[model samples]
Target: MNGKETYDKLKEMAFGEGIDLFRIADADCFLDSEYEGNRPQDFLEDVRSVIIIGSVVPNGVVDPLPKGRSQYTNTLMAATALLRVASFKLARFIERTGHWASIVPNEGSEFGYWYADKDTLRADLSVKWAAYCAGMGNYGINQLLITPEYGPRVRLTAILTDMVLDYDGKSMPLISDACGDCRRCIQVCPVQAIHEDGTFERFKCKEYMFSELGGLRCGLCLKVCPPGSGNP
Candidate 1:
């Protein structure tokens, strides 16, 4: 199949496998980043396209968070695991087409994350940025990818491929500058990790998560965000 045909097939397969959102971004999407140490090309030298896939977090799982943390942790774990499986499946499919494909590590980065100095808490291959480039969604004030369909209640993972695919530019727009100025997350936050401005204090957020929340996951902001709550 040709590039467009192949991309359509892959997108169809992703949605068929329960991916909520999908898009193809030209490899150059990461070229303009100020930091060059971990661009998409850095991982796969021949990569010509980036595939982004997302899954929504169910409202049922998030609504019960204040009562306990197990539901949130379990739901996130399950969703991320599904995303990894989807990435692996997609990569294998791309390889079958005589192209090289690499799945980004979901949990940790190959390059160590420097939290204090750089505020890099998680992994390399910023799937959030990739999703934004693909036009899947934009970052909200809370520093989470907010989709029109699901607000911040979604998780994403990506695949880097050498197979040339049609770039769709951006299919989705930013949900809004602020989530209707709800500010529930900013108000509920015990440590004041989120600010009125889009800037987030990740270090404080991390410390609060570890010290107070027992390291499961503190999604109070995610819970109160109105966009993904089926309101929008």
Candidate 2:
């Protein structure tokens, strides 16, 4: 298939497999602001395009805050799994077409904690940034991609391919301070980690998760986000 044909097919495959959103971005988007020591070129030297795929996080599964732990974890895990399988499938298809494809890990890295900034948890190949670059969404004050449909309630995975596809060139406008003087996420945070400004204390939040949630992820902030929280 030609480049456009291949791109269309991949989008079909992703949506058929339950992907909530799919987008393509030029790999040059990461040339300047890569996380840690990893760059987009590091994944595939010949990479010309990045495929971004994401799935929605069910609001019902995260609405009750801490009480929804089991459901939330299951939903997140399933989203991650689907993204991985889709990435592998797309990568194999690209290889069969005589091109190179590199599937970035759905989870940033095994040692993500090591690089998690004390100010805000960030790791290599940040899926959030990739999604933004792909015109998928923009960042909220809480530092997560806020899609117009799902807000921050989404999980994303990326695929790097050598096939040159048309780039979207940051089509989505910046969300810039969409929280609109609202501080629900900050107010609901049990650990007081989120500041009034657009940043948060990553260490305090992580500690709260480890101690109270028994996991590295706590949905308190996500639970209170108006855009994605399913709240009226």
Best by lDDT: 1
lDDT per residue as tens, model 1, 36-82? 33576665678888898878877887787766677777787788788
lDDT of each: 0.73, 0.73
- Lowest summed lDDT window (length 10), candidate 1: 108-117
For model 1, what is the C-alpha lDDT against the true structure? 0.73
Specify the highest-TM-score model's number: 1
Across 1-232, the per-residue lDDT of candidate 2 in tens digits comes to 7768877999999998888889888777778453343466764577788899988877777776678676777777788888889889989988998888888766521123444544545554666676787778887666677776776778888888889986665666555456887778788888887777656676777677667767646777776675444522
Count clashes in each candidate, considering only residues at least 3 apart in sequence or on different chains.
Answer: 0, 0
RMSD of candidate 2 to the true fold? 3.6
Error of 2 at 218 (Å): 1.4
| lDDT, model 2, position 5 | 84
Error of 1 at 199 (Å): 2.0
